[model samples]
Target: MKVSKLAVKILENESVVYYDPIYHGRTLKVIGIDDDPVEVMEYLLAQYKEKGYSIVVFDTSGHFPTGLFESVLRIEEGNPAGLDPLKMARMGIIKDPYSAVTIVQTIYELDSASTDKLYADFVTGKVNSIADAVKAKKNYSEIILEGYTDLDEMLFSGDPVRIPESGLIDLSGLNSVTLTGMAFLILAAAMEERRRVVYGLYDIAVLTFTGAGNAGLPLLTRPARRRVAILGTKYPLDQVLSIPGPTLLLYNDPDVQSAIYESQGVPAGLRAFIDKGEGAYIWRSPETINVEFGKVLKLQP
Candidate 1:
C-alpha cells in the first residue's frame, strides 16, 4: 500500500474517513496474526524518518533492516565495537544506575554481595571494565570472564560507544537475559544523551522494538522528556493494552481478537464480520475504528 494510505482511515461507513497522522509520542502496538508485523513497522519507520523523527530500535529479530537507520550497533561475537557498560557508567552517561546494576547482576548471576561490590566500584570509578573488576576479585573472575568471552572487547573494554540520534541496536543471537541487559544499557545511554541535548520543542523520538517480547518490557517503561512514538510487536497483548496509548492491532488469534473487540466496545455480532474483513482495528481514546494499513515495503538491504 502507498504511504498515503495510513494518513486516513474509513470509519464505520465507507464514505466516512478520519484523518490519523499516527503522530509522534503516541504509543502504538501493532500485533499481527498470520502477517509479518515487522513489515508494517519498517513502513512506519520510513515515514517517521521522512518527517525528521530520530529512530532508535532495539531488535531481537536479526532480520530487521539496518540500512534504514544512519547508525547500526550489532551485538555479536568479535564485533569489537558496541556499547560499553563500564565506560558509560564512568562517563556519567548512564542515567539509571540501579537499572544498570540490575543488568549486570542478571547477566553474571552475581550474588548480592558481589553485586554490591560491583555497584560500588562502578560508582567510585575504581573499575573501568569488566576485566578490571574480574581482576579485582578472584571469586567473580570465572563467571564474568566466561559470560563475556563471545562479546566484542569494546563492550567490556575500550572507550564508550556513542549513542546515535538514529540507529538500530541488533541484539539478536544472544540469550534473553543478555539481550535485556544490553538493551537497558543502550537505552539508558540514549535517553541520557537525549535529555542532555534537548533537540526541540516538537522533536520526536521513535523507539521501535521487534521480537523483543518480555525482554523489551523494561526498556519500554523508561520515562522520557521529549515526544516519543513507542512501537512494539510480539509483545503480550494485555501488557500493551495496559500502557495507556493508542493501539493499532492487526489480525490476531480469536482470543486476542475477541479481547480487543470487547475492549473497544465493538458489538459482539460485528466482531466476526470485522475479523473476516480486510484492514486492521485502531483503538484511539473514546472509540475504535477499522482502518487499512499501508502496504509493507520490500525488505531493505
Candidate 2:
C-alpha cells in the first residue's frame, strides 16, 4: 500500500475518481476517525513529494515529523531563525510591502495609520526591518515591536528565511492564536507570491491545522491558485463538505456520513462500505468511491 499505488487508485480509474492537476488543482480534506489524521497527512505528504510536487506544510501542532522534510522552520520562542516578513518583502518573496505590514499587524494589532506609514517607509527604503524601525524612533515601533524581540533579531540576523521547495513550518512554538495566525499569513503570502512567478502543475501546499481547531478555519478562506490539501480534526462539518475538490473521509461519524449522503447524493448503503481504520470514502467530482488508504512508514530520526 505505497503512495504510488494510492495515486494509481485515485487517478487510474477515471470512472470512479479522477485527480489530474493539469485539469485542475484539488483541495483534499483528510478527516481522521479511528486513525490519526497526522499519520494520514504524513502518508499523503510522501505521496505528493514522491510525485515531484513542491511542498510547504503549515504544521500547527509541531507534532509533524520534521525528519520527513529537507528543511524546517521552527517559529518557537527563543529561536532566532523565525520568519521575518520584512526580509521576505526585500527578497520579493512577499510580493507587496503592505502584506508584510499585514503580517506585523496580525501579530501586534498595529493601527492602520501606523502600518501604512511603515509600509511607505519599507517601499522607500527609509526603513528595512523592525530593528530599523526601532532605531529610527518610529512613534509606534516600541509599542508594536516590544515583545517580538526574537523576531526583530531574526529580521537582520543576516540569515534570511528562504521558503523551501519541500519543508515543514512548525508553528507549535507560537502559543498565542494571533502569532500562529500571523505565521500563516506570512507563509500564505509567500506561497501565493511564489506561485505567481513560477507556477507548476504539481506544486502543492499541505496545511495541517489539526491542533488549531476552529481558529484554523479563518486561514482557509483565501482561494487557492495551486493544489492545497487541508488535514484537520475539528473543522465544522458543513464547511468541510462545502470545500470543492476531493475529500477523503477516514472518520465514520454518523453525522458526517449523513451529511455526505445529503450533500453529495451518496447512496445510504455505501455507508457500510467504509471501515473504521482501513476502508474510507473518497469523494471526487461526480463519484464517491470506497478505497483503502496507503500504509505509511514512519520516518526515522
Candidate 3:
C-alpha cells in the first residue's frame, strides 16, 4: 500500500500484541480505536499526559498529510470549550472583564489598520497594557504581538506580492514544514488549554541529536513529563538512531530493517518479525533483545 494509505490503515485498524518469551511465551493484545487520526493522536497524548507513556513518535516520513491539521481544527471547532474570555479571566490571564475586552479591542485595532506604521504603532501602545494583564513570568502576548508585527513588516515590507486566496494559510510560497510547524503551534495551544493534551512533531535528526535542548523546542521537557513527540521523516537508521526513549517504527521499509539489524547486530530471523505485512516494529533501545513484532487486527468498517 501507499505510505499515506498505510498510515490511515494503522490508525484505523492497528493494535499492538505483546509477547514475553520468558513466561511460557504468553501474548497479549491491546485493542484500541478512535474516531480519527486526531483523536487517536489525542488519546496517545493523553496516555503521555496521564498514563506516563512519556514520548510517542509516529515518524510519518514527512509525507505527514496536510489535511490532518485541518481535521484537528474541525474537531476543535465542533467543541466549544477552548480559550474563552471568561476562562482567561478565571485563569488570571486578565485582570478583569474589561481587560479581556481590551485584548480583543487591541487585536481589532491592530487588524483594522490600513497602513503598516499604524499597525506597528497600535502594538507598541498596547504592549505595556497586555504585559501588565498577563500574570505569567514571561509575557507571551507581548512577544507574539511584537514578533508578529515584526514578521508582518518583513513579509509585507517589500512591494506586496499578490497572494492567491487559497486556504487559511497561503501555501503558494511557504514550505510544507513551515506550514506544519505553524499549524501545530496554533492547534497545540488550543488543545493544551481545552483538553490538556500536548502534541508536537519534529525532525528525527534534531530530536535524536539535540533532544530537548533545541531552542524553541515544542515538546515539554521530560520532567514536565507529559508530551508526545511524533518525528516524521524519510531518513535512514544512521540518521534517525539517537532518539532518547523507546520508539515505535511504523513503516515496513527494507532499508530501515536492514539498517536496524546492521546497527544492532541482531540475528537474520529478526527480519521475519520486523517485516510483518501490516504492523509496526517496536524497538525499546539499541539492544538486540528489546524488539517485538505485532499487527493491527482488521476490523469491520
Which candidate number would show the highest lDDT if scored against the true structure? 2
TM-score of each: 0.65, 0.66, 0.38
Task: Please list the C-alpha lDDT of all candidates, in the order they appear.
Answer: 0.52, 0.54, 0.32
Q: What's the number of clashes in each of the models?
A: 2, 0, 2
Badly placed stretches (over 4 Å) of model 1 are 1-25, 95-99, 109-116, 138-158, 173-177, 180-185, 192-216, 220-225, 234-244, 253-256, 259-277, 282-301
Model 2, which residues run further than 4 Å from truth?
Answer: 1-25, 110-112, 134-158, 195-230, 234-242, 256-273, 278-301
For lDDT, candidate 1 versus 2, the one ahead is: 2
CA displacement after TM-score superposition, residue 181 of candidate 1 (Å): 4.9
Kindly indicate the candidate among 2 and 3 with the higher TM-score.
Answer: 2
By lDDT, the better pick of 1 and 3 is 1
Instruction: State how far residue 132 of model 3 sits from its true place (Å).
Output: 17
- Cα error, residue 196 of model 3, in Å, equals 5.4
Give lDDT tens digits, candidate 2, residues 177-276. 5456555666666666334111111111222232222223334433445444544443435546565645555546677656655664555655543444
Stretches of candidate 3 above 4 Å error? 1-71, 74-227, 230-240, 261-273, 285-289, 297-300
In model 2, residue pairs whose N, Cα or C atoms come closer than 3 Å (at least 3 residues apart or on different chains), thus clashing, are none
Ranking by TM-score: 2, 1, 3
Arranged by lDDT with the best first, the candidates are: 2, 1, 3
